[model samples]
Target chain A: MKPFTQHSGIAAALLVDNIDTDQIIPSREMKRVSKLGLGEGLFAGWRYVYDGAERAGENAEFVLNDPVFRNATILLGGANFGCGSSREHAVWALADFGIRAVIASSFGRIFRNNCARNGLLAVELAAEHVDRIAAQGAEPVDIDLEACRLTLGDGTTIDFDVPPADRDMLIRGLDYIDFALRYADDIDAFVTRDRRSRPWAHLRASES
Target chain B: MARTLFDKIWDRHVVRQLDDQSLLVYVDRVFLHERTGSVALTALEEEGRRVRNPQHVFATMDHILDTFPGRGDRTLVPGGEAFVKTMRRTANDVGIRLFDIHDGRHGITHLISAEQGITVPGLVVACPDSHTCTLGALGAIGWGIGTSDCEHVLATETLRAVKPGQLRVTFDGALGPGVTAKDMIVHLIARYTAAGARGFAMEYAGPAVEALDMDARFTLCNMAVEFSAFTGLIAPDATTLEYVRGRPYAPQGPDFEQAERNWSELRSDDDAEFDLEYRIDCSDIQPTVTWGTSPEHAVGIDGRVPDPETAGDHDAGRAMQLALDYMGLEPGQPLKTLPIDGAFIGSCTNARLSDLRAAAGILRGRRVARGVRAICTPGSQVVKQTAEAEGIDEVFLAAGFEWREPGCSLCFNAGGEGFAPEERVISSTNRNFRGRQGPRVRTHLASPAMVAAAAVSGAIADSREFAETGTNGQDAA
Candidate 1:
């Protein structure tokens, strides 16, 4: 996962609310054995012709295909982005597409966490603020994780909030597994106590 | 202390709280499907981190398998066999329980988890599939995680998660006939938009929920993900205990009694506090169906399609307009009158034995309407066998519906069988996203009975009306 600190790039505005993981990367595209090379499969349902193949010709109506935003590294989206399914491929596709940041009013919990875990900055701002940023399509916007702010070229700055720990992990390029393992003692203590408290809850293979 | 049901279960599982306020919690059960599970297993294998507890981990080959009768270890999706074989080999090498193709226990992950007693109450269950929350009906805390998180859990029987705020949705009053848990959940999603329950662990309670059977409770919790909720739960009760008493994986005798004793105390205290509360009168809901791409675009069977232009502030107007446009539906059109090309009564959402019975009741004496291709895929081999024993399969087959084996069929047009582009389908599946069933395929999310009614009418017809008249639904149309 790449570390996030400060990034400035072209922003593409996709103002569709409830952009489910299914719509982002349909299940059909997730059949690949490896997670590599799913960037072309991103939004394949809406991104390409209905030929069941990738890059079959872009769907002209889709904003992602708009030549103006072809090099977009930031995505400005509507509320409740990534609402359905917990497919990490949704984030994989976004990252694979060269999108380093996504700004939305809100996001699905799993999708948001997946973004942070994978080093994609998922920024949540007020709906009004997001609308303002989304209106500036394909324009350069600067996102500073340490500053906790996004700056438009016209000197307009909007503050956003990310969990301090999430921001630290992103800034330090840390893995959750390592972070979690640091608290192994606590997990062990809890499990030890819980076994006595709820002995029947244990799944004994012998019972089956 | 008066702790909510979620707090009780969550506190029990907390391994420790990190500096970030997120808890590293022990997970009792982890179920995986081929679509995403294979990735996690392969990652774990590559990392050389063996599963911490193989008995606690269960893998099943769903999602990509063909639901066709006599199907072997083959799949319709190109290169899909690799996933099945990988899951098989990984489960074998790791000593995790695997429900392979042709295994009588093979089924959708969530369904089999409950049916096989893998998801007992007072435990935390995790899975890569979003609808893993379905097991919450058993009074378990079920969290849906991505493949990366799945890998983490496979290596260590715990996951680091931010504790969610609590929300309680209580359903009061009596449910009208033919109004199922599916209707109630769809109504809830429609009332509160898709993100209504965002960041909340929701508990379904009150008289209506308490009165529901175990299977119906699963239906309600299954759609909790549609609301963008972290998870959904219902405290275990006598009904739940009765349902799990003799399942193949459930405890027996003295151990079962001890489990019951623990589960009995798993409910939210009367004085428990919630961050939010919503109360719905069960009688207010009707046989519901989603008319647009998102689940929140639901309207009652008797209601007309909404005029997006009349939507209030916020993105309501634009969202509604987009949904209507993609659905190819006109404002003010009746939802029940629209013709359908396909009717699918299968998926993790509503493919249980009881769901099949509900659909069979409507399809008993009537054939699927002319030109309508209807398919009934049971949720598992166990469900299929049980339905067959009860003549439910004969009812469906005799009604001109294709009877298929269990997996996930026609739920989404991934690679195998599905409706053609522009074809309208009323499905019992959870999602109705644009092009989900096929390219340009218009899907209406509905209950099993509703899907059955549509199949018999070749159009969107109210299931309650068919239930009342016991008609084939063509006459109603």
Candidate 2:
């Protein structure tokens, strides 16, 4: 994971509400077992014209395909963005496509967690603020994770909130598993007490 | 202290606090499917990490596996076999149990988890599939996670997660005829919007929920993700205990009795307060179906397509117009009588034996209308064998519907088999996202009986009209 202290880049606006993970990267495009090479498949359903599964050409109507916004590194979206599926590929696809951050009113719980783990900044801002930023078109926006603020192209700034733990993880490029391992003794104590109190809940090796 | 059920579970699972909002929570069980499991396991191996508790982890080959008769590793999605092969090899190398294609227990991750008694009350279950919330029907804390989280759980048997607030959604009164759990959940999402329960762990309560059997409860909780909830749960009752008693991995004899007593105490206290509360009258809910891409675009079966002009707010109206354009539907067009090209009854949402039996009840003496392609894929090998023994397969076959092997067939086009482009399909699956079934395909989410009714009529018809005089034939159990 790349540490994310700050980033400044062009932002594209896709203001449709409930922009689910399927639209971000359709299941059919996830044919590869690996995560690499998904950048081309990001938003495949809308970014490209399809003739029975073959990408016949780019759908120039899509915001991402617009020449002015083709290099956008930040995404401005509507409420409940990435609202379906637990596919980490959606976040990976966005990161691979050069998107460093996403600003939305709300997000799917798992998708937000995926973004945190992958160092893709998921900022929750008011819908009005997000809409205001989207109105800036392809202009560059700056995000300061350390300061918890987003600066629009017009020099106006809006405060955003990322959960404290997720913000710490992103700024430090830390793996949560490694962080969790630090409390090994606490985990072991809980397991020992839980096993005695609720033996049936713990599956034995023989059961497997 | 009158703690809610969610609070009790969260407190019990907390190994330590990671931050002001996050806790290091112990995971009791982890379930995986080939689609994302292979990637997570391979990544873990590359990191030189081993599963801390392989016995508590279970994997299956479902997401990308072919459901054709005599199917093997071959799949419709290009390069899909690699996923299955990698999952099988990785599960073996990691020493975790793998329900391969030939395994008699092979099925969708959520279904088999419950069927095998791998998800018990008060346990924390994690999976890589969004519908993992289905396990919450048994009073468990089950939520979907990304591959990185999957790897974290596999390596440490614990997860760092922010504790969610609690929401209690109570369904009062009884569900009317032709109204199933699928309708109830879809109705909730449609009325409250997809993100109604966002950032919350939801609990289903009240008389209507208590009346539902285990299968129906599973159906109700299966769509928690669609509502953007961390998970949805019901208090474990006699129905849940009875369902778990005889399952293969369930506790035995004295242990079973003890477990039952503990599970019986898993409900929220009488005075427990939730962060949010919603009370819905079940009688007001009709057999529902999605008319557009998102599940939130659902309406009663007898309702008409909503006009974008009345959709409220410019953004919502624009979204509705786009959905209408994609669906090729008119604003005031009635949902009923709209012709359909295909009908499907399967997926984790409604493919258990009970779901198949409900569809078979509707198809017993009826034939799928001409030009309508209908199919039924049982949820598991055990469900398939049981349905066959009960003659449910004959009903589907005689009705001109294809009886297929058990797997997630045509549920998201990952298996490479789906309805043609622009083909309208009435399905019992959970999602109706754009191109979810196939390129340019249109999908309407409904219950099993509703799908069967559409198959027989070759159109979107009110299932109540076809119900037998005294019964709706929609109850799973």
lDDT of each: 0.85, 0.89
Residue A146 shift from truth in candidate 2, angstroms: 0.3
- Give a tens-digit lDDT track for model 2, residues A1-208: 7999999998899887888999999888887888788888899999999778688999999998899999989998888999888999999999999999999888999999999999899998878898899888877899999999988888999988889999999999997788888888888899999999889888887788
Estimate, for each residue in B199-240, the C-alpha lDDT of model 1 and write its tens digit. Answer: 799999998888888878899999999998899999998888
Q: What's the lDDT of the predicted structure labeled candidate 1?
A: 0.85
Candidate 2 docking band: high
Segments in model 2 whose C-alpha atoms lie over 4 Å from true places: B468-477
* Model 2 lDDT tens row, B244-286: 8888888887878888878877999999999999889998899
| DockQ for all candidate structures vs. native | 0.64, 0.82
Point out where model 1 deviates above 4 Å: A51-55, B468-477
What are the candidates' C-alpha RMSDs?
A: 2.9, 1.3
